[model samples]
Structure formats: structure tokens, C-alpha cells
Target: MKRIAALFPGQASQYKGMGRDFYLQYQSVRDIFNRASEVIDKDVYSICQDEKMLQRTEYAQIGIMVLCIAIFDVVKREIESPIQFFAGHSIGEYAALTCSECLNFEDAVKLVQIRGTVMGKFGGEGKFAMANMGSASNDVIMEECIRFSDDIDFVSLSCDNSKEQKIVAGSSKAVKRLVEGTEDLFHGKVINNLGAFHTNYMLEAQKEFNETLCHAKFHEMKKVVFSNVTGRPYFDETQVYPLLGRQMVKTVKWRQTMDYLKKMNIDEYWEVGPGCVLTNILKREDPSINVKSADKILKMEGTGNEKIC
Candidate 1:
């Protein structure tokens, strides 16, 4: 049997009609969507179809997580390959956990709704910010991030997507400084963030998330799941909640995650989510690596890999 790594994409991978085809074709998917709507009372079915709502961090996070799981639910039954590993990018981790059986689908939806609202309240509302910086060595990027985070406002080195991709989030002032400080040496894009994700700026949300998590039941992982905090499979079932709780303020070690997967001799990388971002990112890192989105395994045409047109 081929060793498989199942990955999930994060926010910004959402589209207006991402899960519509799946919902239409699969009764199971429709049930998942409807249940998600009832769990959060946000009409997730309508949220995915509305452009304005999809753009909001709070709504987008919930919709994205639900879409990932709904798609995974179908893909799981279709695929013959046994998955050896699983990882999600940021908010995608919730879906990863849900699929891993660490958290139930209803609890996952409820958690993401709270996550979105809090993140949107802080980062999306303009209190906090995020930016993608690149075209420089990792050392240079870390130096600048550390300086701003320590001396200036709270800036965090958020997502390490790859050797060339680095994300930072913090106070708006600090992120602005990050952009200005690196403008001469590198290129960057300021992202519309719902919160200072994976940064200390999310402490308030982390607290609430922790409190909420206390009420949610987390089971042992049914399959190996990588954690953003460590860029490694969770140490044990007991660490699941704590790691997830602290995940909000920790850097997502995606670069390390890919490195770890390679070391594990993963033969195929499967991205079971709305966008191909996770699979594509891995491909860019190593062109020879085998990568596939859920569409191929599910034998479906619309995986929402393209922009909604």
C-alpha cells in the first residue's frame, strides 16, 4: 500500500460556490451543510453562495471548514489509498481534526464560528493585520519579525508555507512596519486577516477558544495528524486540545511539515479540501512529488480549484 499524506487548505481558498456541486450531488454533503448551518445558526448554505458573506473572515472560516469536511466525507469512501498523515493550513486544521476524529463535525463547526467571529473582531476589523513576505532568506525574515514583535507592537511570524513563503501577523502598526522594513529587500502582500492568527495578538480569542474547547470532546486521532505548533504529528491524544488551544498564537510550521513528510517517505500527497493550495505548495517544493486534489480521487470535475466565474 502507498503511504499517503492527506492535507487541507486554509482560509482564502474559499469561493462563492465551492461546495455547491458536492451538496447538489451528494445527500451526505447536503446533510453536512445543513447540520453546519444549524450548529452555528449562520445559514452556511447561503453563506457559500453569497460573495460578500464569503469574503468576511468569520463566515468564510466556518464555510471553508464545513466544505473541507463535507468533501472529505465523500472522498474518504471513494479512495482506496490508506492515509498515513494529515495536516491542515491554519483554519484548515479544524477540519483536519474533525476528520481525524479528534473533534466531532458539529463541534468543529461551532468552534470555527466562534474562531471566525473573534478573529474577525480583532484582525478582520482592522485592529490586527497579516502580510506575506518573501524574496529573502528565512533568517532575514525572522530577524525582522522578532525585532518588530519584541520592540514594537506584537508581530508574529505566522505561517511558514515554504522556504520562500513566510506569513507574519500582529498589530496593524507592527505589520505596517514589517512591510516598510522589508520593501527594499523583498516583495510582499498584505492579507485581509480575521485576526492576528498564529500570533500573540490572538490571546483573547485563544482564551475564549480554550474555554469553548473545554466543553468539546476530543478523541484520540484515528489517523496521524500534524499540528501547526510543532509541525509534527501530535505527541499524544492528551495534547490535542492544548496544542489546538495554543495554535492560535503559534507559528504554523508548514515548511517543517513538508520536510517531515518527506522524511517519512510519503509516496502521495492528497489535498482533500476546496482549493489545491496545499497540494500545489508541496509540488512547488518538490516537482517530482505526486500530488492530487480530492476531485481526482472523488472522480468529480468541480473541486473549486478555479475561481468562481
Candidate 2:
């Protein structure tokens, strides 16, 4: 028995004209991109065409959501499988909602657009995140995180392909402190993210996002969508709004979420957006599982199916 799980990627995973392929291929994809352009009063296509827009936080958010949604739409029409669940990283949660039908594509795009704007506004300056690669236990890293939580906030703990590799999110000051405290110091390599995301530092943006989502309409999910906050599957409409809001300010529980899916006997795992990041993470977590990037998905050309561990 194989189950299908769709993984939606977050911000830093974006690339140029991510939706152009689908936009040229699917009317629905074009319509969705056009609707997003209308909501923001900017030519999203132009933004997609321009390299600068795709790199900026705000435009990157819109482009990524549109592309991810479009990819999901293509899969829905072209492939048939018993999809067991859906999950997303950070802003990718909105993409999960669209896949689950909890929110319309237009509304989901609007939400993320505003989300990116708000994040840029309140996430403050002089703060950023860094990804650390290594083989370390969560508890050891978490203990290290807490040692600096007072200033660093230890906003996120991402389980990479294996227990030894993980990404930590926090302010520059705190991250620096943690690195200095640790032996080998991330093996001397750290990727500085554009902002301090997924930590308490973004709470102000989360507040505004919550208010906006509270007024929006969400339907009960026809399928399971996992919450990054709790690392659990939730399909109730009532829970969706709160969960999405908390996501901005909470740690992404990627490790627990995947484990939960494995326990449910998921068969296929598809990373539905740009980059093979999630696919790599899943494979590292369990090499026996079958996972593929969205490009691999499009190449399948038939039943884009696989078994997750």
C-alpha cells in the first residue's frame, strides 16, 4: 500500500519565472498568476520576467506561491493517486491550503503577498538566519539553542536529510553566539538568510496575518494538511486559521511532521515546487523512501506516483 504526500517549499527555494512553464502550458496557471497581479496591482508577469523581483522577499513570495499552486494544479489534472497528506515549510503552508482546497488560489496568493510585505516591514533590520550542516542530536543543538535563546530566539530547528544536519533560525547576534559556543562552528559554513524568519522576531507580522486570515473564509479540507507548528495533520477549518498564523512565529517541526506521515504509511512523497531541497531532506531522513522534485514529477508523464518510506 503506497500513499502520496505533497511537500510545498518555502521562500528561499524560489527561482526566476518559476511559473512560466505552467503559464505557457496551462490556462488555469495563467489565470491564477493574472489574478495575483490584479490583487497587488503589479504586473506579476513582468515581475516574473525581471530577475530582481523574483529575488526580493515580496515578489519572491508571490512568485513561489503561484508556481507551487500551478504545479499542484497540473498534478491534480494529469496524475491520479491516493494522496495521503500535504505539508509546507514556512510560507509554503499557504500552498498546502490551496492544495487541500482550504483556500482558493487567488486568496492564498493574496495572503502570502501581504505576508511577505508585513514580514519585510516588521521583521526588523540587522537580523538574519543561518543553516548549519552536521550530524548532531536535536537535544544537543536545542540545548545550545536555549543557551542563547534570550537574544537569538532560536526561531527554527529544521531537520535536514538526517539527524546530523539541521538549520537554525534566529537573529545575527544570537546565531553568532551559538556558532562561537559550538565546536567546529557549523564546520565553518553558514548560509545567511535574508531575514530572521520563523522565530518570535516575526511575531508582529504574524499578528497582522492572523487578523487578515480571521476575516477570510476557509473551507474544511477535503484532504489532510499538516501544520508546521504542531507537526501534526489537521483538516478542520476552525483550526486552519490559527495554525497558519502561528506558523510565521513558530519553529517548523519538519522532522516530526515527516515521522507522523511515515507512521501513517505514506507511499509517495513529492516536493511540489522549485528545488529538490525537501526531496533531499526526505531521502536523508530515510533513504528507503521514494521522493522526487516537481520537475521529476512533470517528467514522469504518466502516473506521477512514488512511495514515501
lDDT of 2 by residue, 1-309 (tens): 457899998877876656566677678878877787898888776776667777677777777777788777777665477565899887788899888888987788778888888887776535666667476776777787788767425534543324655777677777777777675644523566667777677788888877887787888778899888888988587898778868777767887888888898877888887777788878877789978777432433475643212
Best by lDDT: 1
- Taking all chains together, each candidate's TM-score versus the true structure is 0.90, 0.87
State the lDDT of candidate 1 residue by residue for 46-130, as single tens digits: 8988889987888889988888888888877766876668899999899888888888888888889988888777565567777
Candidate 1, run of 10 with poorest lDDT: 300-309
The alpha-carbon lDDT assigned to residue 303 of candidate 2 equals 57
Error of 1 at 142 (Å): 2.7
User: Candidate 1 clashing pairs?
Assistant: 119-194, 124-194
RMSD of 1: 3.7
Alpha-carbon local distance difference test for all models = 0.80, 0.74
The local lDDT score (0 to 100) that residue 153 gets in candidate 1 is: 81
